[model samples]
Target: MALTLALAVNELGTNSVKYGALSNDVGTVEITWSLRPGAEGRGRELVWTWVERGGPPVSPPSRRGFGRFLIERVLAADFEGTVKLEYASAGLVCALVAPAPEDRAS
Candidate 1:
């Protein structure tokens, strides 16, 4: 799970640097996450949001890239959750929902 998250983050960073918000001087990316109790008898669930702002006008991709595939498909399948990618005029936004690991014994 950690690896998956790391790879997802890396891809986002790379995309931002190459063509997204971080491509220019005035843009920014904000990433945040929260944990909530899972549904049914499951453990915790993680909700992560990635919001990019102040960049070039955003538009949905004509074709799906590998990075998008990883974030939207691979992670969703692996974590048994849902992923949403939004291309707003301001920037791109991604919301990832996944099952989180149980809290460790303390």
Candidate 2:
């Protein structure tokens, strides 16, 4: 799930540069993630958002390239998460959220 979100963010960042506001010097890309307390203090949930500003307008890529498709598919299959697209005055944004099990790494 971590890898899924990371790659998804990475792909979106690259795509922002290629197709969104980040194409211009005035653009900015914001990538952020957080672990929030779940309902009633239960398991944590991970949320990530990527936002970019100042590039050309875009429609979703018509063809699903391997990286783009893979990121979406992985988020769905492994984490049951969804990718959301938002177009704003500044630029474009993608937000993702999923349940995350506790890390056992010592």
Q: Pick the candidate with the highest TM-score.
A: 1
Tens-digit lDDT track of model 1 for 1-106: 6788788889988988887899999999999999988778577888899999988988888998898899998877766788999999999898987778554211
List TM-score per model, in order.
0.85, 0.71
Q: For residues 37-106, could you state the per-residue lDDT of candidate 2 as single tens digits?
A: 7656657777777777667765666677876676667765677656666666567777776665563121
**Which residue pairs of candidate 1 clash?**
none
- Candidate 1 regions exceeding 4 Å error are 39-43, 103-106
Query: What is the Å distance of residue 24 in model 1 from its true position?
Result: 1.0
lDDT of 2: 0.70
As a whole number from 0 to 100, the lDDT of residue 67 in candidate 2 is: 67
